[model samples]
Target: GDARGAGRPTGERSGRPTGDARGAGRPGEARRDSGYRGTGNPAADRYAAKKSGAGKPRQKPSGPRAFGGERFGKDLGPVRRPKAARTSRPADELDMHNPDGVRLQKVMASAGVASRRVCEEMILDGRVEVDGTIVRELGVRVVPSEVSIHVDGMRLQLNEDLKYYVFNKPRGVISTMEDPEGRPSIGNFLKNKNKNERLFHVGRLDAETEGLLLLTNDGELTNRLTHPSYEVPKTYYVQVRGPMGPGIGAQMKEGIELEDGISKVDSFKLIDSTPGHILVEVVLHSGKNRVVRRLFDAVGHPVERLVRTQIGPIRLNDQRQGSIRVLGRQEVGHLLASVGL
Candidate 1:
């Protein structure tokens, strides 16, 4: 009785267990309490047990210490193998609106069917049909497995063989396709040419001037070659109505001051001379509008006829004023070598 507490009253519940039948003294059994007599509720006994055991210390389960020790396991069991890459996530996909995706016009152009812009116009005109259905939208995308595209009712195929050529264009042809004013264009020379590859001029050539021009379907190469900062050399043969004096060549080489600014020729030389006419060669790296004509005019020798004779290592080579020949691989290589390509 004295072990219960000092000077405790008789039969008082001391919030602890005495050696009674309810106090089973087992590992998981609850301790007995005189205050809980006749309660017949196991919930209150379980709650009391949980509250008492929570005050006791606890031990962490087996694993490396989350914050302190270096007990990381040595089990090398292939690490649950990262959940086998899901096929639900696609490897690659084509987006119709993306510029680099499989675009309708570019697909037609690659098929040797027509120029991209022309194909676009054809789609708008309902001339281009895919798998027997007309596709008039601009950004319609198609994959190789999903498309059987046709232009003008004929199946199309992509041409892989790239062709590059240089043309020493003559005057009287506009650079564009079907000019609004209905003037003749250099494209006439390319029309119905029995060539498999469709040709496109890299840069513009004005109606009244002539010079070396590059033509190819290789857009990347065209972009690189025609960029103005490349400053590729272009040589011209100009005939003036009057003899250009000796010092005139020097002054032109030194850059002729025009109404706009100092217009310059890279080099110049008098080739042939007559009392009323002078034939001279002028070299320039500029593609400015009528630059050679403007320079000659600035120097008091308005050009009577202007013909571009050479561009880089390419020459006109006796080809008629309105003819074109495909450039050989070696020639293309030489051009690629130029401009530090």
Candidate 2:
């Protein structure tokens, strides 16, 4: 954006800007009411202004600067921008009213949707929805926490009470917030963390196991994710002794009997292998404690190292171990929708 301005001849930096000629070193600078402009050079600017009849009276434009602060061809009169394609509808048709409630634009802006004015345009353009219904009205009022808002069909989470985070749980660290045995726990990473109100780990990862562990204060989401009924997927990276036999993945997908129950992997992939050790990926929805280790043990491979790389829609990705990262709006939205929250 600055490249064009940097190379501009009439910029504030191109020689002295203060002179008898108004806006010296500024090229094509003209009043909205007047088309006559300055062309940088003092003598040339005076001549051009005189030639264009700079002093002639002009009609003031009555509306927005949609003309891009300069004139375009007269044919494209007042066309704003290319909004996303959606069925055109009258905003006033939907009469969602709560006089005491906050404005829709305010809620959207607070949720990081966009600036207040841009949000208004989005509402007017029919890009925002509330409670499964498209709402184009700018004055629509509803409680941010109560309504399910979506922008362009992506869910927007607006509950300020809820917080979401992803932590890379390194090996040797206990999963609990506070360890009674005085071992390194999740609390260590949160020492300087200011937002500790009701912050809870979503699920458990054994002290020896490591990788992505979702942390959140949203109780309902936590319960739903860990609950067996929802069957939220969790993926793990397992390191085990190599020269492993084939079809272990098939055997897993088929069924593997355990003391508690007959559990099976949703998916399995051989990530890497060598004679000494091998890395494999295991996906399952079971929340059983130490399930990954037991799965490998049942297959006669025995897990040497284990890492929970992903939990449902959230992935560890490139985050460094022992670090905590806040889940963004999109991530939180998908997470909430995963279990129908």
Clashes of each: 0, 1
- The whole-model lDDT of each prediction reads 0.66, 0.81
For model 2, which pairs clash?
A: 10-25
Model 2 residue 251 distance off true place after TM-score fit, in angstroms: 0.7
Residue-level lDDT of model 1, residues 110-171, one tens digit each, is: 65556898988787776876656676677676664456565655555333366766666777
* Pairs that clash in candidate 1: none
Q: Give candidate 2's TM-score.
A: 0.70
Candidate 2 — which residues are off by over 4 angstroms? 1-95, 115-127
Report how far off residue 163 is in candidate 1 (Å): 1.8
How high is each candidate's TM-score?
0.50, 0.70
Cand. 1 Cα-lDDT:
0.66
Output the TM-score of candidate 1.
0.50
Angstrom error of the Cα, residue 261, model 1: value is 3.1
